[model samples]
Target chain A: MHPLAPVTAVGRSTLSMLAAIGRVTIFLGATLTHLVRPPFYPREFLSALLSIGWFSLPVVGLTTLFTGGALALQIYAGGARFNAEAVVPQIVAIGMVRELGPVLTGLMVAGRVAASIAAEVGTMKVTEQIDALVTLSTNPMKYLTVPRVLAATLALPLLAAVGNVIGILGGYLVGTTRLDFNAAVYLTNTVDFLEAADVVSGLVKAAVFGFIVALMGCYHGMNSGRGAQGVGRATTNAVVSSSILILASNYLLTEVFFSA
Target chain B: MIAMQDVHKAFGPKKVLRGVTLDVARGESLVIIGGSGTGKSVTIKCILGLVTPDTGLITLDGQDVRRAERDAFLARFGMLFQGGALFDSLSVWQNVAFRLLRGALKRPRAEAREIAIEKLRRVGLTPDVADLFPAELSGGMQKRVGLARAIAAEPEIIFFDEPTTGLDPIMAGVINDLIREIVVEMGATAITITHDMSSVRAIADKVAMLHDGVIQWTGPVARMDTSGDPFVEQFIHGRAEGPIEAVR
Candidate 1:
């Protein structure tokens, strides 16, 4: 084999990845432009809010509750070795409010909401509904992506705030019962340890993550290939890409907010 | 009112349309027929601007369609997709009145719903069907609903893709008749893509046969049977052995 063959293959793959990224960037830009233009679809936006926000509460609540409880127990166990188990309440509250609450909720919602949106829209694309929209004089991006992205951005922060409260309550329950910490003292410690910046930062992250998640879903759906196999591929890609991007963005946002 | 000149489209290794050229007159129902994957649907898509041709001019009236303001240009046309393509979340009336409820065409919800019902009734559906979703309708009923939606705004032009593809013979006949009646009554120029000869016979004023990315034959529907093109002859007769090979 030629010495440059491996290098050429790597270069080709990199270029393909860049092309994919460029396409998504163009899609997102167009969606944002349409969102701010006239012909806004209030009906579609309301439906999306109900679908992305109100319908998502049960899952976000349940996931946060369990995660908080698990974190409290783990921190207690780790701190016990140094006879510093009293720190568990503070750590659990900070953990849930500062990072885990928003990130985990985002990941879970990305899997559920993003996958559904991708599959539904992808199926429609394959079945020619998108073309129908065009012929009907409706912009598909305005009719589809704008509402979804707006709903997710407006809803995810509220979901995250609810998740934070529930998650802190879970930590409180575990701290008082399993670890024998006094309920009032644990509550006071949690309140004292968690600053407004921590909560605000998490909500901000949720909003950004929400936009990314819904954007990925709409992008993949609108650009999905033909047939059942193509739709399946798009659904899977939407979920995986959204989740990975959410986590990576979470880390970057966290570093920006917290790093000295 | 639609014209395509020297339209060419290719998909990677496979070329779909090549130098396809045709013209449709106002109030004329033109049906294009060809075997599957022979660019019949692609030609319709190109005319609708859903798929842009690599090199060609598609003009509506005397204006260049490819360069026209897309939304303004598209507002004059309606399409019935092969699958009906109704929004699953929307009710029948909502789907039908989708165009009338937005942009410059916006109307009051009640008014839109009334127009939707009127269109539905024109296609032989009752007002009650307007409240039901597309999923609740039978295939034939869904096709009727699609037809109703296509004409709800009474567009100047309409395109129907595989209007009778999955229907039984009787339902197909009903749909064909309905299409003909609606097109005549509305005086709208219509383009239909299908392999169903019965549909071609029932709905077409002019018939164009697409083969290997070009219009191979164009004539009145009555002359389609006698067209001297070997490809059109083999296709219309549905013969297994012909110059067109069946790929395994």
Candidate 2:
């Protein structure tokens, strides 16, 4: 009703958003602090590693396989613009290692792992299992968040590396069988084109993305509102935010790694 | 002893606890009763430090709860939540043995399992229930397991929040009986929050009636009916017409 109502609404929304960022930053800082502190849960860490890494393999592997095959085809076709079609092996290898492999693996794991963590922890929060943990003299951050974040951070790089190999193999398979290229020559060109920097950068991106994914999931979950709808919203926010942060961090990391 | 003085807590514009004061001496069983959303649970949470008061003093054994070392302080108390709050991922024995398996109360796996089975038996659950996950248990069984967990570490103080919520009356009676027996046998200080009158009669040595974010009346259980406080009278009698206005 007031003339200044529109401005007030915008200001309120902006303030709320900033508050959310501040809270998430605090959650992240606490998680990192607890990660190094001891009375660590080796059982919880091993279990989380199994869930986030080993369980994620099939989905990450499948996504990269299909993506690598398609990337090889697209590169071959695009190269034909200048009759440079034979560059498929080189381009496919570079593209998969430098960008697509890590990004896709990150996003896939984000969707699968982040959503589960949020739903799981959100349920725990609302149902008072988290409070129960507190009453039992255990820090939920140390017990729940640290193990999960550490597992994801450590596992994603390994997952990405495996994804890189599988993806390159996919490209190799497609180039040789579907595109009628010499298998040995394609392998040599693929091997020759990808530098160590490319692989390292992608793995590093995978690690950061992994951290963002679990952090968002834990952050949203521990702060979730009371019931089923609250947990559902936390899960959605975890997946969406993690996916977006993954892409954003990927670009930023790439720039930092490759830019002069 | 646990003591609270003029405890006040608010969430946004909704003031849940205006000014609450209560006390439970060591080895006493105190039951808090109020309608839903009347801050009955908040009062218990304040004592446990699960929820901090906006303003007031809460002390346990003469130590300021806010200043107590968290692990050492928490080690003295255990709680049973309304929903059982069992970790779905953990089997029943593991849930019961949660405190024993980690942190300051760490025990070897075999010893913890033995303690878990013993506690579960104390709560009238079979040893067979130990290996099964919480999801496989019914609401009553889950409550029993939650009770088992609360006593696993044999804490000096125990709290039961809406301990009979969502269970059948027969199961509720069993839980109430178990609570009374456990409190008496362990000689642990007990605090319970509930609107259920049956729970009050079964569990309270002293009863406190909460209304409008404050303790309206508190007295020994024998004097509850004769206390003549309108809020207590209306709440205990389930009266619709009284000084205590029922929300439509």
Candidate 3:
């Protein structure tokens, strides 16, 4: 048994971790560099906008719709204990707008969009389609990564805005129909409760989350190993990494936006 | 014309190319033959600058490729990847006309489609196949589509990687004939990588046998059988015993 074997293993893992971070940072830098450069592919960009935005609407809408309803019920029940049951509209509005709307949408997109981008691009890498693009005098980053990232960055905020409206509607429906509250009163309380800052902050977080999701997808995909299993791993890593980054960044952004 | 001098490439500890040197003259067709894992693909990729050599010089028309503007340098070359590598999302004509619809070679959409259909015809495909997706085509048809895409831009240098691999003998023969006819008609410099002797015989103006990370034998296709190099003889004859050891 070598005395420094444990130390060696730790050192090896640390170095590999650092190397992976270095690679991801470099890929992110290259993506940013290409974003500003010319030879843009508007066709690819338009197609990506459709994939990451329009197709993603239903899932984001549905997820937020349910969460808003559930949140109204939970806040009502918890407030009942404090003899403050009527705060349902205010709490639900604030919760949905400030956190649930953006975070839930980000997670759903991490599952749907990130996995999709990773699998598609990973398969392209495996099949040499990416190399084929290179041989055709096209830069893969400019043609591929830039479009999806830009689209997701733009689309997520739009989706989050839609989700906010639908989510507040969900809370309104539950408050009025199920909770024995007047519709006009619930709507008034909800509108009065939410500030411009709350909505803007979530949308801002959504944009950052969108960038993270697409970046992780493109990064894992472009660097995928050579086969089905490699692509599968890339897809999984894309979802996992983006989900974690979204949550982590949400906290950091929230702190920056609302900390005392 | 393409030239490689003392090319070397390594992925981690496994060295793929070690001091590989070869040349193809202007408008000549050269077929590189080697066993699997002999760096044949890597050698081709190096010439295309897809794989950068650790130590070597690759030149095109007496100019260093590394110094060439990337787009202008790549514009002169067309490639048929072994797996076809067609964009499945795109229909057949779109795949064939990919370059013609984008980048420096871009044409009007209608013009690109017309040219794509013409290239498809030249490769023995019907105009209807142009509207179909790559997945709808058979393997041989896919290969033909890939060939069509390769020549769509009218490149000065054309690379066919394993042109006859995984095809029926008749289909392989047809593809070989198309490639030979295309190369000669276009007067393009061609480099094909294949282990298939028939592809070599049909396509090579000159044959270079790559083995052990270097050129073991190279001469006119006429001199291949009598090259007197053990590696070349053992490879072309498909013998079990050879100077070049098999992986298995």
Best of the candidates, DockQ: 2
Recovered share of real interface contacts in candidate 2: 1.00
Model 1 DockQ (Cα-based): 0.83
Off by over 4 Å in 3: A1-3
Give lDDT tens digits, candidate 3, residues B144-207: 9999999999999999999889999999999999999999999999999999999999999999
Q: Tell me the docking grade of candidate 3.
A: high
In candidate 2, stretches whose alpha carbon ends up further than 4 angstroms from where it belongs are A1-3
Clashes of each: 0, 0, 0
Q: What's the C-alpha lDDT at position A153 in model 1? A: 94
- For B64-164, candidate 1 gives per-residue lDDT tens digits of 98778887888898889898998888899999998888877889989999999999998889999999999999999989989988998888998999999
Model 2, B1-248: lDDT tens digits are: 99999999999999999999999999999999988899988898888788989999999888899999888888999899999999999999999999999877899999999999999999998899999999999999999999999999999999999999999999999999999999999999999999999999999999999999999999999999899898899889999999877882
TM-score of decoy 3:
0.98
- The most accurate candidate by lDDT is 3
Ranked by TM-score, the better of candidates 1 and 2 is 2
- In the order shown, the candidates' DockQ scores are 0.83, 0.92, 0.91
The reply for model 1, stretches above 4 Å from the true place, is A1-5
TM-score, candidate 1, first chain: 0.97
User: lDDT (0-100) at residue A127 of candidate 3?
Assistant: 94
Q: Which candidate model has the greater lDDT, 1 or 3?
A: 3
| All candidates in order of lDDT, best leading | 3, 2, 1
